[model samples]
Target: MKKREVLLLAFAEHPEQREKCWISLSECNFSCKGCAALSKKERSRLISSKDLAYLVFKSSRYFWGKIIKIAVITGDEITLNPESLLSLISNLKDYSVKYFELSTNSFMIDEDLLKELIKLKLPILVKMDLKAYDEKIYKEYSGKSEVRVDESLNLFEGIDRRAKLIIKNWKIRYLTINPILTSK
Candidate 1:
């Protein structure tokens, strides 16, 4: 059977007052309770890397002279589809994209993935979510252990030539805090 693939597009505000066209892939490892996006049960079609890159290249033309600031690739968990995701990003290097942003939860990032990303040498920004500071809260919300979060963050920070590596905190719309935890 073929792997499931999806690309959701939208426009959003990027850092430094730039506007970016956002593309999101679906299916995630974690199903955080408050997430607004639909569940992973939704089906998706398969798209090849060349076709994906072509879509982004064509999308850039809509802005004309205004330089399409960046192409933001996000998802329920893009890191889960490392090969496809990287392939698409790598192929976009020749397009008008000035930068590429990959938004992920950091759970799927291992040392190997980090090494591969560094090797790509694409102007990429990683928007990662820390979720929660406490292990219990993190597990409660994201249904996963927090071990990989710190491990991934530390690995990303340890990159020797890290001028290109950016560790970012993702935004959460609503967070319910436990009074006991909040009081501490």
Candidate 2:
């Protein structure tokens, strides 16, 4: 059976966003604890930026901006494929599309990419998932406590992306500092 895998963020922002674009994981290799989807049963696929765009354009009606507002993609680590991420952002920006929010684990995000990405001035917001607030807890959750929290903290403080270009630059948005929590 040639099964077609389609993924949608069940906890999406708008009812229309889900119907707008069929999203998928980036086949990410980062072992993250803050990934809610990790403990849940969901479906996703590895799709290209072009494919993602077409999907959005096709489902414009469901999209928040009605093809005018930028889409938001939250996940464990979206910066895995730099080219794909850049392409996706570029394509959307070129078309005057704004991807407002993206939740990520900054395991792979670098400074240069951040600079280039901010150039679009597309009102991009990044929600970085740092496993824990403290070094020990962060390491326990994300596995690399040695520098994950410190590094992530540094990125939040040091990375000088403009205000309009950024909405929130924190490593993790909410109070949930530890990445993953299991109800064992």
Q: Relative to the unseen true structure, what is the Cα RMSD of model 2?
A: 9.2
TM-score for candidate 2: 0.64
The backbone clash count of each candidate, in order, is 0, 8
Please report the TM-score between candidate 1 and the true structure: 0.74
Candidate 2, 1-103: lDDT as tens digits = 1112224532223333332232334334455565556324533554457765655554553434455365566554566666777777676565556555666
Stretches off by above 4 angstroms in model 1 are: 1-4, 12-19, 38-44, 63-67, 160-184
Task: List CA RMSD, all candidates.
Answer: 10.1, 9.2
Local distance difference test values of all predictions, in order: 0.67, 0.52
The C-alpha TM-scores of every prediction are: 0.74, 0.64
What lDDT tens digits, residue by residue, belong to model 1 across residues 1-184? Answer: 1232553556544345565667666678987888865324443445666776676566555544344567778878888867877777777776656788888999998888888888987777787877889999999999998998888888876554334444354321111111121101
